[model samples]
Target: MTIGVALIVGDTLRRRWHTDSPGTRGQEFPLLAAREQAARSTAADSTLASQLTLPEKPSIAVLPFQNMSGDPEQDYFADGIVEEITTALSRFPSLFVIARNSSFTYKGKSVDIKQVGRELGVRYVLEGGIRKAANQVRVTAQLIDAATGVHIWADRFEGELADIFRLQDDMSQRAVGAITPMVEHAEIERMKRKPTHRFDAYDFYLKGLASLNLQGSKDAADEALQMFYRAIDLDSGFASAYGNAAFCFVRRLVNAWMEDPKKEIVEAERLATRAVQYGSDDPVALTSGGFTLARLLGELEIGEQHLHRALELSPSYALAWTHRAWIRVFQGRPDEALPDLNRAMRLNPRDPLMPGYFSVMGMAHFVAGRYEEAASWCEKAIQVQPKFLPPLRTAAASYALAGNLQAAQTMMSSLMQLDPRRRISTLRELYPLQRNRDWELLTEGLRRAGLPD
Candidate 1:
């Protein structure tokens, strides 16, 4: 089975790149436009940090770097650098790093450092700028103590385009060391490891990340998959790209967007396996690949092991925690899932994928027979993403189980309008709930809510 799946994925990848080159796609669909749309959406929904409490460990937010290159097109480069720095810092279990989505909300704005700290619930803020002229680049960064408005550390790095990756590593190390001097030298060395030797592949991966951050939209997900595939074509060892490509399929499964479910599942599983194999030390790859395995392929134990490895690698990775929480829910351990969900929410309160966290929370509650609470969380998820199917299905089932026939029917009506083909009989295939009782509960609730057999 594994060899057959590998051959299928290998053929599909070859055909895809043979017909489509990265150059033409970039011209047809500008990455900048996609990034701008995502930025606007992120800024609009950036309200998760209202009077937040400080974490127990040292916390910091890396704000969007200013583009000093005198070209608006350089915004992506600057933003990508900040995101890389943020990700590198997040690997440390002792540092509480604000997610890129939350920190980038302050882009192109002149803000007081103290206010940024208060809004992000961090003790420190790292702000920087990038200037690229000819084949050379200059970068400057300052670490500020947000509470006292004091500059703790500041530095500048200058290097050629070829040395850009080294410059980024230096900046990440400097920022991490300045914020938490207690971080081990080994951890700093781990942050210095480059994702890819090819700059083009890294660029494509960054573009893919921008598209993935948009979430919810099928078009965005497709674009992200294409970008990741392009990256993989340039650098086959790029595990993060492979992992994210698999996650695009996971999104399709959740939203009922797969045209050929069986084929897509095989492809997703293949991509996920490659991600895990190549990215044994990468948290993003492990988290995405593990979640895809659990949700799409029903490899619950293997997926949980991958997720556990991801958390062990980067305890601050909110998505890993969220994925692990869902895995617990699928394993019929709702009690074990809730705390992980809460921890994820606290780590990255402004994550764009909060609706997903909410939906999984609803599932956990539903599995635990807390019908009213499940309905509430699923309703919140629906409000954020009205067309999302899982939350809508769970909301209907929860309301029906709670004996609110009118609410249950209303939710079912909305769900059916979104995906008319969905039936109670398909629940098992659609959801990988482990326990027989949980399956029966969902089927009964859906039946009560007027779903067809």
Candidate 2:
């Protein structure tokens, strides 16, 4: 029972940044460009061009909470609070949350709002500080209009150290509560939010989440898995960590990065089962666990039930919708999956994982017998992640099915370069698609593209 430092709050601050040059550090981000275009199209008004283009959904960035405890060891606690807040905010489909990695780039630095807003492409920013004294903590936070430097909301929360998790949940929900009223007073949607109760386990989970966001290389994923495993060891009841650990195993298997697929699959199934069993009330845990069960273990019915419950618990959770869409396609119901996929895209238009979303959309289209549209979507996915084998394979199959043999052959060659051992013979074992028709469609396209059957 080691509680290093509880969260402490300081003061409220607000500022705005403006454009100076074409190549300003944060002004020319590609991520922002895409978001701006999406926002403009959604607005459907040329008159609004003079104003700052905001996303269809209110967008925000939660900067790293400052550690005012003076003891640097409490740094982890401060970061953990910010991560939890970010996660809670992301659960809302009507809110566009800048990922933790992008927002954390400003950690410990004096940032201009113009630069931050431009770089992150967020309309609002939340900043805060924490000060801990023994068993009690004080937390102060404020929300700002990035374009106007106006302080829309601010608050202070103080609680005993034993209620650290509750404090974090309150802080996040309160911030969302404040922002929604300020921005969307006409339609303020509320949700039943849940939090992990254990502080020690949560600390490790936060660290693991940060590592998972890296996704830059295999080393990063492995490190994330290690951190998640440590969290599970510290608290075997930490279901979210188990769910994430199972996902890491799925990633390895899909990318052909696993040295022993049989062993990893067994471990993944065990973790997924445990995650669902223990995390019956946790939406994130249910989403990830259900996805792993259906996608990797072929347990479609149980997986769909968990996912359905997750959505019922947190209807605005975009990831759960995305996973449900994925399961639907494998269930030979691609038409039914399209709405969920589109809903996911609208919820987080600037998601860093848009490549995967695009690839899934392509799969939905492919299964609906729309080969050309499928090829187009898969191309976008491959553009975002060239070496992403799933999208690569999807692109090849779509192209071949569309009668573009040359393009299909080119895509297959690229896929083979990434995974030299890939073959149609193992598609069933790898994808675990439940519907026979869906499996046949996938295999037939790949075979037409020259994949060894």
Candidate 3:
């Protein structure tokens, strides 16, 4: 609510640091137990400085750069420049860049570089502030040793706004060039990092990503969607936020959580397009855009390409992985979706939507006509999230398919009691299955389970 003044990448922002309490800061980061093993690994090249040629392989997070330009109109341009730089840094492949959502957690806040390093599981961090005036832009960047709280590299560039692309490429190349070997040597031992904050819009986005892992009740998923919408309202031009929100809507539509899948898909389309238009360069927007198009519109080729480009830009995105997994399941390759789902689960096991992922697995099995397996997975989902909705619908169908009418009816009754707006018309809209096989499988069970819809 308090939109305090804050600086970006380089100049220190004056906003109250989110972690004002030493206790909060201490609770935010745990010691690098994983790094301890790396420290004692007894490197063949004992001197890190001497062996600087060994790719630094540090995973750096580029926090959101503030649009310090006087004109609010220039905000998008500044953001585009920062995104370009982040993309370029991610390209090194040897260097891992934290997902933008995670980095944006520090936006508008005063942060301790060491705390950031520890929280994000990076040995170093690259951050700066952007100030643009007239046609000219100034970007200041610095690399900090998260462990020692020292700046390893710092530089400032003043250039025409039109030349911002050139500046991004140049800065990113130098930064990557500087840390390549150190990152590589340190890569295997690195623990993936994310910010510890939980209340802000940025944190909400991360939680939204985590929600993609849900095993199945609609409760957590609805919660995630609210967060995504909240984030978008907080920053309308925040394309990634919009993109994810749209994608979540599409997921709800596909899984029959909505009363009208057709109408919801239309809304999903609009949100996805808004994301791309607003965040043309943001990997998150691109990825979510692709996912929405693929899942809701069923445009496989273009959607797949967009998703691929997004992954290329931000490979560590757990949501992207889950989206890809969902795409595969729809493509009739249920087996293939498993690995991607597994990866997402591993990345954030405690994600809010974890039950959804488990439910997806269950749905895949049920659709594949493996009723027993579907029931088992649905049970697993129930174990994780007792009130999740998708798994409930899935269980109803799975049990019905297995000829357990009693159990199936029980789930159906629970669903109706929890949400009484059930009717065949509403169910049809919610589960718009174009495929005969999919329609038959889902519809038959629901009908058999005695749901009017």
| Candidate of highest TM-score | 1
Q: What ranges in model 2 sit over 4 Å off? A: 1-80, 89-125, 129-140, 145-149, 156-163, 176-196
lDDT, candidate 1, 1-453, per-residue tens: 012332222222332521355443432233334444454345334535465789889999999989999997677678888888887888888899887876876788899999878877899999989998888989999999999999998999999877888998888778777877788888887877777889888878877877777666666677677788888888888888889999988888777777667878888888899899999998888999988999998898999999999988888787888899998998899999999988877776665556777798899999999999999989877776677789889999999999999999999999999898888776665788888898889999999999999
The estimated TM-scores of all candidates read 0.89, 0.75, 0.54
Best by lDDT: 1
lDDT, candidate 3, 279-343, per-residue tens: 65566788888888776777656666776676665666666777777667666667887888765
Worst 10 residues of 3 by lDDT: 18-27
lDDT for position 351 in model 1: 59
**Candidate 2 accuracy as lDDT:** 0.71
Across 17-124, the per-residue lDDT of candidate 2 in tens digits comes to 001111111111112244543432333222122233467777888898899999976776788778767766776656777656446657788988766676556788
- Candidate 2 to truth, TM: 0.75
CA lDDT of each prediction against the hidden true structure: 0.81, 0.71, 0.61
Task: Rank by lDDT, highest first.
Answer: 1, 2, 3
lDDT of 2 at 446: 94
What does the lDDT read for residue 318 in candidate 2?
A: 70
Question: Candidates ranked by TM-score, best first?
Answer: 1, 2, 3
How much is the lDDT of residue 64 in candidate 3?
Answer: 65
